[model samples]
Target: MRPSTDIDPAIPLRARDGDVEAFAELVEFFHVRCLRYARYMLGEEEDAEEAVQDTFVRVYDHLGQFRPDARFEPWLFRILANRCRTVRERRRRRESLVTTGELPAVAAEAEGMSQDLLEEVEAALEELPAEQREAFLLRHVEDLSYEDMAVITGVRLSALRMRVKRACDTLRIRLKEER
Candidate 1:
């Protein structure tokens, strides 16, 4: 679940230069990770898929604006995060009063955990405040550095660290309560 370190440095440059094949390669490389992030954020498969599609479309359209000196992964994630927020806002507006008790299933399975423990973890994650959840996921799940997270989320570094710390504290308390 770490941020990919093997991304080709030339791919973003080629993509910016309007190389369709290069863009396709970027999509192929990033799609799964993007989908995973979107799903984790949005908590629904359909919404995640839509958000990722919209993210790619926006990426293609705005490729010209990408700065050559900047890292592409953070820039791409920024767009995807924005797309997820937009989708979430739209869903909130559309369904103002949803009352479902069913929790959104976690997409990733823990290798050595029992099903009950996994459920507890997923529920604990779901209970986090949205900002905390995003910060925690970007830091622990995606394994991005605080600087990279700040770049992607536009939050100050100290604030991001506080959010992540709060998230971890909340998760620990919640998981212990579950046990």
Candidate 2:
């Protein structure tokens, strides 16, 4: 299940003040969603977990750097997204040096569907360019606004919108072909 995206104002305030409990609360709150996004972006459980863990550590270390006026969710996601990108880059580098027989795992768990359809959808998602996939997942799955996505991804609003549009179009065509 996806975690609620709501940010409690007090949590960040307390966390920034070096309250360990508050930081733990923040981790508990954002962990699921971060893991979900990382898993989809990296396509491996171990990589996803590592990314999420790294994200939290960075978040804690940089808590004092957070702007009080800025919304916390976007800032948190921005960090998580960067971690995912780094992990992806590392995996790419490693793959070049050594060929592996591992397959990309499903980004999200699924149920009550034909296994073939699930696999097909996962394959389609994997085929998308990284930017498109991130755009699609952030906009559709995470339900973030274009402005928030721009802040998190550092992409211009127009470019992010175009990426989401292209991602949706691609997914529709690919899934339709599979039918």
Candidate 3:
């Protein structure tokens, strides 16, 4: 009997059978938040996209290894986060690192955001260290609890909290700088 915690039945079963389409469904499910996390951690669209792709490939290879008791999203995010780390290391080695591109041209302010506000948030995210950025994204963007963050990152819970705090402080300073 599958102990249910709200997973798509199609995913684990089909994925274990080497079904690429079922895996693609998983990718589609995670794509937006994964891209956001990759973008924030890697500081570039291309790198983020690559991280997401690499994550999916790794997921395919490791599908059979997934524990039945685990939450799929956080597990997948963990793989994505690790890939982002590797991508960042490679970019550092390459030494021609580029930050995320400018937001698409904003003709008019939407809701409560101005273009400058969007730019400031982007800039702050860009300045965060990779680990800090990953912590931030996992905590706030993905709304994962600190325990979940620890599970995903394989860090102690206290350490994950500290990383999240530092990330928040750094982002606050960066946003302050824009004032």
Q: Highest lDDT, which number?
A: 2
**Cα distance off (Å), candidate 2, residue 101:** 15
Count: clashes, candidate 1: 0
Tens digits of per-residue lDDT, candidate 1, 1-179, equal 55475377789889999999999999998898788788777877788889999999999999999887878888889999899889888886543222233543453344666678876776778778778988998888777889999988999999999999999999999888888
Query: For each candidate, what TM-score against the reference?
Result: 0.86, 0.86, 0.82
TM-score of 1: 0.86
Tens-place lDDT per residue, model 3, 112-143, is: 67778766876777667767877888887778
Q: Mind sharing the TM-score for model 3?
A: 0.82
The better candidate by lDDT, 1 or 2, is 2
Backbone collision count in every prediction? 0, 0, 0
Evaluate all candidate structures by whole-model CA lDDT and list the values in order: 0.82, 0.85, 0.77
Q: Where does candidate 3 have its weakest 10-residue lDDT segment?
A: 1-10
Residue-level error in angstroms, candidate 2, position 29: 1.0
Task: Report the CA-based lDDT of candidate 1 relative to the real structure.
Answer: 0.82
lDDT of 3 at 8: 89
Question: What lDDT does model 2 reach?
Answer: 0.85
Candidate 2 — which residues are off by over 4 angstroms? 1-4, 93-113
Task: Indicate whether candidate 2 or candidate 3 has the larger lDDT.
Answer: 2
- Ten-residue region with minimum lDDT total, candidate 2: 94-103
